[model samples]
Target: MIAVVQRVNSSWVEVDGKIVGKIGKGINILLGVVKGDTEEDIEKLLKKVPFLRIFEDDKGKMNLSLIDIKGEALVISQFTLAGNVKKGRRPSFDDAEEPERARELYEKFVKKLSEYVPVQTGIFAAHMKVFIENDGPVTFIINSKEL
Candidate 1:
């Protein structure tokens, strides 16, 4: 599992012109499930994301966490994050998990993360237009295997 975590002033996901999920003053997560990913991967992420000290403190240092600031989360399924472009010009999604299993893991991640911070989610497997007002343009790429 991989997550592209961006701190955002606000974010929202729209599908077919209808907004499905939205959040404010929090993190926007684009989550991907790849081949061989499992619940243990979710466990790794759960132990990291909410406690990440990417937010700033009153002293202007990056000392606060999402949980410390009582922030929300916008989680979105993003299979294309598994795309490999090392060989051909066309990206290959051969590393991505199957849709059904991917969705299951995605939901589990969202549900677990929500327990730590308020969470909203884009519809799984839908074509989505994501609007992100990135806070300080702060972002991080987290992989379960790397942690």
Candidate 2:
């Protein structure tokens, strides 16, 4: 499992012109589930994401966490994040998990996250237009295997 976490002042996802998920002053997570991902991978991310001290403290140092600031999260499924682009011009998605299994893990991830803070999500397997106002332009790439 891999997550591209971005600090955002606000963000929303729209599908077919209808807004599906939205959040303010939080992190936007674009999650990808690879072929070998499991519940353990989900658990790893759950332990790290909320407590990440990427937000700023009163002294302008990056010391505050999402939980400390009581922020929300907008989680979106992004199978393309698993694409392997090292070979040719085209990206290969052979590492991405099957749709059904991916959906299950995605939902599980969201449910677990919601327990700690407000959480919203985009439709699974849908074409979405994401609008994000990045805060501090702070972003991080998290991989369960690395954690």
Candidate 3:
């Protein structure tokens, strides 16, 4: 499992011109489930994301967490995050998990995150147009394999 987390002032996902999910003053998570990812991977990220101290404190230091600030979350399924471009010009998605298993884990991830904060999600496997107003332009790329 991999998560590309971006701190955002606001974010929303649209499918076929209809908005499906949206959030404000929080983190936008583009989650990818790769082959071999398991429940443990989801657990690790669930523990880390909310508590990550990326938000700024009153003193202007980056010490506040999403939970500390009572923020929301916008989670989106993004299988393309697993694309490999090391060889050919065309990206290969062989590392991505099958849709059924990927959606299962994706839902599990969102369920766990909702326990910590208000959570919104894009429709799984849909063609989505994401609009994000990045806060501090802050972002982090977390890979469960690295954890």
TM-scores for the candidates: 0.99, 0.99, 0.99
How would the candidate models be sorted by lDDT, starting from the highest? 2, 3, 1
- The best candidate in terms of lDDT: 2
Candidate 3 colliding pairs: none
TM-score between candidate 3 and the true structure: 0.99
> Candidate 3, residue 139: CA error in Å?
0.5
Q: Kindly report which residue stretches of model 3 are placed more than 4 angstroms away from their true locations once superposed.
A: none
Over 4 Å off, model 1: none
Please identify model 2 stretches exceeding 4 Å from their true place: none
lDDT of 1 at 147: 88
C-alpha lDDT (0 to 100) for residue 42 of candidate 3? 99
User: lDDT tens string, model 3, 9-128?
Assistant: 999999999999999999999999999999999998988999999999999889999999999999999999999999979999999999999999999999999999999999999999
Error of 3 at 5 (Å): 0.4
